[model samples]
Target chain A: MSDPCIICVAITGSVPTKADNPAVPVTVEEQIESVHESFEAGATIAHCHVRDDEGRPTSDPERFARLKEGIEKHCPGMIIQFSTGGRSGAGKARGGMLPLRPDMASLSVGSNNFPTRVYENPPDLVDWLAAEMIRHDVKPEIEAFDLSHIFQAAAMVEDGRLKRPLHVQFVMGVKNAMPVDREVFDFYVRTLRRLMPDATWCGAGIGRHQRTLNEWSIAAGGHTRT
Target chain B: MSDPCIICVAITGSVPTKADNPAVPVTVEEQIESVHESFEAGATIAHCHVRDDEGRPTSDPERFARLKEGIEKHCPGMIIQFSTGGRSGAGKARGGMLPLRPDMASLSVGSNNFPTRVYENPPDLVDWLAAEMIRHDVKPEIEAFDLSHIFQAAAMVEDGRLKRPLHVQFVMGVKNAMPVDREVFDFYVRTLRRLMPDATWCGAGIGRHQRTLNEWSIAAGGHTRT
Candidate 1:
């Protein structure tokens, strides 16, 4: 038997131009199908980023509610992972879609080159995001890119903003960001493990990087999902 | 100004099949051109793993001599890095290549899963390799993957078998081995830093893992060449 674990299919992650992938699934009806298909394909988690009707990225509370309700109705036991990532003209990203109070939300510590602009998450933003996740009864999946991010995440856990057995994603393979080399990956894992000995973590790759570290995750006895 | 770093061109390493890439040079002539191209394109290091005359992987002394002569005549001052990774035949790697003792040699510590085989780098072999590198004025680069590898490398350095200002390669994203994710990469860096605070290390990727960590190396500000 395979591992009875949570496999989250991150849908509509990269904000695509219409010229990119047409099947990005922006509306509620389309998101419902996408979640249903992942459920049928044996995923226990549905990681989502909401977009407008015309396919523009949005952090509108109503759209998030519609997407959550649709997914919950279509697939009952699936975990709902809402993104705190806000696109252009969406204002500040921290706690942007937290009002809906999904089962889980994403939180990143430290600033990185997120496409054209930096995904700026100051220390205060992390504390606020963690507090909101606790308030909304949502589990915050800590996203980290470099060494300092791990340190920042630990600070949140220590300050009582996050609970123990933390879940983190060692994101890699982004251009002008951290390199996804084996020794670096080994170091990345060791540093976090040293800092928070018992934290649960996963590995992710930008673009096709998901192709490699996911396997490393499995080898290292960490949970790796598609 | 751009980074004034020495680039290492891996003309051919141990882990490649015909199905992987056809451009993997297998002969002295091909290796010479590969080195020449690398020098012309801003590389100052050539990490070599010699193949037999028939294009199959081999570690014969004659082939090593030919490769050295070719590099000396074609691209002088370009550093040569040889591998202790031997073949399955001839009973635990032929012992002649070590005598040539190039400018550098790779000493991969810890056991890891490579392809279908278990790469067992016993502690005894590590000590022997370290001693060999020290004897010949060849710098020993401790190659590692996963957390255990980091631990082993640190132990080797602590034992005084490996030299100071430790040189290492953060190899990431290889199948059946540790990954090249940001978390893994940074963790490795953190662990190494804690053990040997001033160590200089670089990174590498396998197959299609080209520039991911290379750019990360530049941004993170360490030894970015490997």
Candidate 2:
């Protein structure tokens, strides 16, 4: 009945800006300081996204490298997970930061709807991103926006594209994507365990339900993203 | 227990050609003939897609008009459902034929991964399509490729974007989309019932699983497409 909870902090997602919340970190130095504070406060993992000089999301490998260096210097042993999310970039550019070889990178294996547009993770792009992660020896945190994505990850694992003992995160409460529901969360955990017995999983709830998912995941003996 | 199954025949989908199967209909006359034959064979609904002169898929309104006229004249009382699927056109072009006021039109309320690319049904596009469907009084066969889509349709119904008593089709067995699974199929039915008690549903299996979904739908008191 005991499990160690791994708290992953997504300091700055692709969305949300200073206008939305002034505390949102947008620069590499600010991100490092914010991540160090999170690490000191008990977050073991830093889920990161890079922004350009103008504070727009970008997949610049150099920016990623600088962020990684800053985090490693300030918060030693803290897990750094770069975001390869679609909003930051498109096609191969999304994986451009993989060469920096962070501890982990967020990967979406299937496409689903976002708030206003389609989160386009086509098969070829998915395969390519996975291959890049493997080549760079960077672990992937599978983002399961829908039920099929869990199965897609399993299929990729079985097909030798992804390694076993998978790490998946079930995200909910997006506008056009899966909403926060207790039954769906329970089903997701059950299905993940049934499909990949050795796999580890987590839960992420967007907006106001974030803490709700954190509690649910921790109580269910899974990790959590904050 | 008193459910009467509505059999739908997709005479010519966006994919497949005379080259793949010489019997595959391409021209307007061929499509009408094929649909008429299907109507005679017990199909109540004709799911249609028009092809160009060289056999490529097109969203040409003139061709759709001709096809509609032929189906109406040849098989009275048969339901004509045009495919507003992504392959035939992009953006508003996909809904151009909705003004023809066919009995129904296939509508994808959410996006998912197709075989080679993202089947992008963006929110704006989905909203626009639904608006057009409402304007033309054409019933939408909500294409539920994944579980969340059912919830999306339910939300749309609640918000008045889509009418009540939804018509959803669970599509399975595409390469990157949802695969054919009995557990998933059952879950879809149960979830649909739980979400929208009065709503009706259908099932469609691509390629090899066509008959399997048909059997499942018929056995479960739902409609089916071939």
Candidate 3:
């Protein structure tokens, strides 16, 4: 219990916009300001996703570089974690910003259903992303949307596709994907520990289930993302 | 221990061909002969897949109808189950043969990574296939490639997208999909029972793990597919 809990703040995800919430930071400067505020509030990691001029999600590396620079300047020592999530782009575009070598990047090691479509992380794409992370010395924050993804991450680590001392995030409450079930959440923690004892994991819940995951994860001695 | 087991034989999958094994049946007559042999050897269920003239997998309803008729004549009383698997076709084409209405059709309720690509069974496609199966009076053998698929099937049954008294199949040993693990197999059985108390389930393991799943399933009081 004496160990510090790392608070990761996802300032703006790919889906939400000003229409959804006017407080959602879109521009690089706004994102930097928001992360600075979160950093001041004791958050140490800034999970980032950049948007285009029209405020649509994009994986443009130049925009990411600007965001990274702004964050590093505004919130010193804060972890910069870019999202390689499918929402931002398609195919190799998704990994275009990995070369920026932020402190870390969110990697989805397995595929699952999103609200409307299949969140496809094909095996090759996952391997390629892992390779990119390794080449760039960017630590991966494995996004486990389902039970098997935890196993998939363990396998990748075992096979050297991913490095050890893994950081995994259990995502729940997405429609058509894994729902926020306490029993399943507990199983995720137990399975991750069994698969990779040295691994540090976190839990993320979408929308109304967010508070529940944060509380459960905190109580269970795991990290939480807000 | 005294429950009679259902011996299901997958005569020809979409992957293996005559190049892989000369005994692999491609045409309707070949498939009929193969099923008849398996039927004589006590295979109560014949899991069928059809190939075009060039030996490529297809979801042609005419071919499926011919195969169904041939099996009905040759393997009398044996169950005919067609594969609505992704390898055979894309989208609704995967379920084209359902209208022919064999005894059953395999249905994947979720998406996951295959060795080379994403084995996509999108939410809408799964819903469509399940609806087709229901419309055609074709019982679906729910394919549980990953753990969440079991839950998805349970949810479908709960919502009447799929009828109750479910029959589910747990597929393992795919390259990038679920690996053959005894503990996972045991958990699958336990979870299925917990989710759908009246459900009957089976275990299918690929390649060298096939015998292991068959043995484990029989020893654990579930069905086995070869």
Candidate that scores best on TM-score = 2
Task: Answer with 2 or 3, whichever has the higher TM-score.
Answer: 2
Instruction: Specify the poorest-scoring 10-residue window by lDDT in model 1 chain A.
Output: A85-94
Candidate 3 per-residue lDDT over residues A159-193, each given as its tens digit: 89999999999999888888888878887898887
Best by DockQ: 2
- Give per-model TM-scores: 0.51, 0.98, 0.97
lDDT of 2 at B32: 94
DockQ values for all predictions?
Answer: 0.02, 0.85, 0.74
Better of 1 and 3 by DockQ: 3
Best by lDDT: 2
Q: Fraction of native contacts in model 3?
A: 0.67
Q: How many clashing pairs per prediction, in order? A: 21, 0, 0
Candidate 3: interface RMSD equals 1.0
Candidate 2 per-residue lDDT over residues A63-113, each given as its tens digit: 999999999998999999999999999899999989999999999999999
Model 2 iRMS (Å) reads 0.6
lDDT of each residue in B1-226, candidate 2, tens digit only: 3768899998888999889999898999999999999899999999999999989999999999999999999999999999999999999999999999999999999999988999999999999999999999999999999989998999999999999778899999998888898888998998999999988888999988999999999999999886
Q: Tell me the TM-score of model 1.
A: 0.51
| Chain A TM-scores in order | 0.91, 0.98, 0.98
Candidate 1 chain B lowest-lDDT run of ten: B86-95
Would you give me the overall lDDT of model 3? 0.91
